[model samples]
Target: MTSIIQTQELSYEAAIKMCVAVTQHAHQLGVSVGVVVVTPAGVELASVRMNNAPLHALSIARKKAYTAASFKIPSFNWQERLKHKPDTMSALLREENFTYLGGGIPIIVEGKLFGSIGVSGATEAQDIECAEHAITEQLNSL
Candidate 1:
């Protein structure tokens, strides 16, 4: 029999900090957005939606976070990675929690993945910028 193992997961405080950072960045850009952070197991730790952000953004942000944590890759990369693989692309698209758009980013530290952050409710570029800013701010705080 094999024994089960565990690894470091994202802390609630860290997840909230990430969401705040992304929200601040979006505010600075004069954009309303939604942000979500998830653990390595794809469990949501924290989430926020700006006052004017679309209601749909809440679910989208969560999906992005889940996808990033589940795959350990930037959500945007999936689009390019699957561009030439129609079958794979179609299959992935069929997933209820999968998103190939930008704004999802994995949080890796010391070669270990802690979780992921996702932003939505703005242009893809804007969403990506917010996600990146959150990561940079989180790293700096550490």
Candidate 2:
């Protein structure tokens, strides 16, 4: 029935692997960071905070994951998308767990959205790199 929808469930194992991989990458880069993996519904599955990662990073990372999963778009891209739509941007910023940060990305599996990853505490470039590398080397291999 059209009213019933089937959804792919994200595995907790994959989420934990993602958290570890992201943390490893951040360490290799000499950047302490917070990493999180979440389902498309924005429920967190795994989370990590590398040594010395800022206390605030955990909250920011979770929000970044939520934003990407909820919107199915990289969180950083929101900056440009709402650039000309100030009213919308303002409204969005008012919401909790939403950010236009570069560390957030959507995870695609077999041409379908799986979930999302978000990293924080380092430069935006470094955060993005760690997330991408973990997803590519860890999740994509699954």
Candidate 3:
């Protein structure tokens, strides 16, 4: 049997707003960063790399966002959960667009996973802070 499922997604405008907010927060922290927002299906809706951010940050940020959206959990959680399972971690790491980093966060509203945001370029803590700030602000505005 085939059945269709409908899911709510983050709008393009919202994704842009989130990316902008993350960029602003990164700037306020005196860091250049790359930010990405992805839909529930792991499709990137918006992304930005601040001037002087690391050249590799943009790709990492997108992968982080995709990981969070596809797995429905913060990217760091995967690292923590998989650390003790070497075999599982090795297998998961082989998956495309899967990153176990702190900067990726799933954006949930009213218990629904709408999408995700990822930030990179600075320390993992700083990147996570920027992503968290943007997601919180967006959720609060809802």
**Which candidate has the top score in TM-score?**
1
What tens digits encode model 1's per-residue C-alpha lDDT throughout 12-111? 9989999899999999999999999999988889999999999998899888888898899999999899999999999998999899999999999988
* Candidate 3 residue pairs in clash (backbone atoms < 3 Å): none
Would you list the C-alpha lDDT of every candidate in the order shown? 0.92, 0.90, 0.92
Candidate closer to the true structure by TM-score (higher is better), 2 or 3:
3
Output the worst ten-in-a-row residue range by lDDT, candidate 2.
1-10
TM-score, every prediction: 0.96, 0.94, 0.95
Pairs of residues clashing in candidate 2: none
Which lDDT tens digits does candidate 2 get at residues 1-142?
4998778746889889888988888888999999999998898999998879999988999999999998888899999999999999999999998999889999987778789999999999999999899889876576
Candidate 1, pairs of clashing residues: none
lDDT of 3 by residue, 1-142 (tens): 6598888999999999998999899899999999999889888899999999999999999988999888888998987799799999899889879989889999988789999998999999999999999988887888
TM-score of 1: 0.96
RMSD of each: 1.2, 1.2, 1.3
Query: How much lDDT does candidate 1 score?
Result: 0.92
| RMSD, candidate 2, Å | 1.2
Report the Cα lDDT for residue 126, model 1: 98
